[model samples]
Target: MRSSVDKAAVKMSRRWKLICVPTVIVTVIICFTSTYLLLVKGTNRWGSGRGLRVNQNTRRTGVETTRNFSRIGNREEKTRENITKVVDREQNKILMTNSAAVAVCCTDLMNLDKDKAVIIGRRRKNKGFLTIGIPNTPRSFGKSDLKRTLKSLIQNTPNDLGQSHVSIVVFASALDQSTRLSTRDIVAGFPEHVQSGLLQLIEAPRSFYPNLSALTGSDLYNRVKQNVDNAFLLAYAMDSADFYLQLSDNVRAPSNYLQSIRDFIKQQGGAYWVTLEFYPVGFTGKLFHGGGRDMQQLIHLFTEYAREQSVESLFGHFKDLNVQLRDAVRRPPLFAS
Candidate 1:
């Protein structure tokens, strides 16, 4: 019986060893897998700063060593550089298009001038002349909007007003390359009017004015400054227009808009500075006798206001801007010089 019991005990001990061996192996495998997984996850989460590298130099010293390896920062720098290059390329394309548009417009201008003598003769018999100045900015570069605006003006022009007596002047700001090209294309569609000296396109060089994108002020202030500057330049260049009307490329006028303007001018007796209200709050810039003494006076007053505050406080309601202008005009000139 003692011999049998010893044999059974030995068999039980062997069974337990078999089960324990597999359990030990499984535990070791689990520990190793968890360690490897943790290292990999940590390296990925820490943005390349937590990775390890085996150093072969340690073999010379009879030791094993590891060091952290990182390339995330370098990768980010490369990404930024690539982005800048793309932006520069896009800007170059825009500039190229702008140049092409300017060239084409110039050619059109030359053709128009070839027949200037005939145009001048027709203009002499017209009752009144109108010069329309439109400024195109990068932000406001909508081809459809510009086309619609110009088409509306052409379609709505009073029957009594000769097309030769009207001039549409476009001033494209420096960064408005796309707008310039698009506008030139649209104007080209109307060959008869362009050849008649009724539509003129002008491009302002990128260096003509301060960087509008870098201006430090409210958006309204920047817009006001740009519009005023464009109007001032256009007026300064005007030589023989009886009225200078400034219109935005986005505004769509009524069918009678131009006719109403003519009537209004005739009613006002031709030599006046009138601010027409489009909306109840804001006024559309329709300076009668624009590019004349009245316009010069208005520009002078605007310059004074711009100088007084560095154009910083020129924000607020649109009415307020108009009020400031009226007040500036009412106030006596501080210096006649």
Candidate 2:
């Protein structure tokens, strides 16, 4: 599942791309630059010292250990292959192809495939009103990462509002075989959620990513390549429901928060809107009211800025351009960290 992180590292460009891209990015970023540093600082401090937990140490130990294991496994596999090289070479073709698919599984963690995302899941037949996409990584800083986040969300949010009104997608974008299996085990604890079709664990193929080294910019926004991964979660959530709400891997909300959001959206009627902010600080508690087309527009907008700036920094610009009349009005913040 490792996607050449060493190769993904690139030196930040000294100068911005002036003539190639739109000037609006520079102009808006400059105008909104005042609060960005503070927003990030606040984002890092929320949720019982867990906050967003975007740090360089995320998954470091696990990845290094996996690499060591992979080296030993490869050497042993090579010796075994050499023994039967010519005898079973042709017969192993199908097995090798299947192995590659399983190795990548459904996760192109590096965003290697740019054109189309290959999403894999079970019981995808029933759609929902809202789909919460939690973009999760293994070996993160938080002691109570997905387990806490999923519990808060599932417990507070009702299982049935009417025929699968809501569902949770834990998009484990990056994980080694060990971590991946561990994640599945953690999620397996929620048997009712999975059996009821209220939750699903989905993954993408290796071909679904772009060249991260090309899209990357300053380290400020590219910590562990989370900016790209967050956007990946948003894009993946488009097909899951009528509305998409993004939440952090370690976040909590007040009880019945989903019902409140549903009522609020209903009260709005047919008003044109871009995004509904739930949390005051970052991208964790924002409810995006859109279907596939609406989400596609947002995915394009955010993915452009995701390379150089945090997603929270781009929210103001998105609303300004898409929903010019929308005010900064947000419902009482139910989500924390």
Candidate 3:
């Protein structure tokens, strides 16, 4: 009876142990699931932080780029303002002087505008007839031609046209340093009557049309003509002139060419245009056609080998050339007129 009682108690203890083991396993699973959920939530928050950092970095880059462009624009504007101030200052100085007559023209020479000015000599302000106008590049002349031209100019200056002043306007690129130096030397050889008017030189910092390549002769000529015309307009706004003379360094003329022109204009009631004849040093000459009316005339004259036989042909040529004053040159075209 004692042995059977002991065996029954052992069996009961084994059943209780099995039940406890299952309860412990269930608790452990709940703890592990809670930990995993917490880890996933933390990882999601970390990913959001990284995205915020990227957005901030991008915004900073954009701001920096915008600021850089603004700074550059401001710098360019300031430079242009400074240049304008300089130009105005020089113009003011010229206005203050005792200028009677003015001739406004543009050239590539650095000091052309200043050198060509006609001013009363430092000692002789009353002798207006003695005034001289020296162009930056005086036309080359043979000894005989120079003598005769000067003689005619000195003799023919009209009494009615009183003392006048001349202003040479320079339109040149600052890059042309060597040419500028040579022009200065040549201009300095003139007599004391020739004085500098506006000594300021105009230059554009960048190419006017930077996007385009400088091809085609016509395109190149237009680019140059526009800049020169701008300078001329500036001078005209400041003061009207007795006349405007067009010249170039390559167009060689007599030393007295300027004097002769001045005298001729004065004698002809100061209402005429003057231009020197030009031919290419080379056999094949490239001439300007549509740039300016004066330039077009030269082009038409050079290209049309034989004169138009009839008045109708001449008129047609004039119309084709876009000559502003349609009937100015009639009939035989007066070749040299």
Query: What's each prediction's TM-score?
Result: 0.47, 0.57, 0.28
What is the C-alpha lDDT profile of model 3 across 42-140, one tens digit per residue?
Answer: 322423442212121112210111111222223223443353344345333433333332121122212234323322222222212222221222222
Instruction: Give the TM-score ranking, best first.
Output: 2, 1, 3
Show where candidate 3 strays beyond 4 Å: 1-163, 168-174, 194-240, 251-323, 327-337
Over 4 Å off, model 2: 1-123, 138-144, 211-224, 328-331
> Which residue pairs show backbone clashes in model 1?
none
- For residues 1-337, write the lDDT of model 1, one tens digit per residue: 9999999999999999999999999999978766675575444332454445432222211111221223222322334345334334433432244465434433332233322322111222333477776665555343436777777777776544636567766555434456566767776776766666566566544443434456666654555566455434444334547777666676776776665665655653422123443322122344445443334434433332332332223222121212222321211211110
Candidate 3's TM-score:
0.28
lDDT values for all models: 0.47, 0.57, 0.32
Query: Between prediction 1 and prediction 3, which has the larger TM-score?
Result: 1
- Tens digit of per-residue lDDT, candidate 2, span 150-212: 888778875455236887888767745676666777777888778776777765554455555
C-alpha RMSD by candidate, in order: 23.1, 25.7, 25.9
Candidate 1 lDDT trough over 10 residues, lowest sum: 328-337
Better of 2 and 3 by lDDT: 2
What's the count of clashing pairs in each model shown?
A: 0, 9, 5
lDDT comparing candidate 2 with the true structure = 0.57
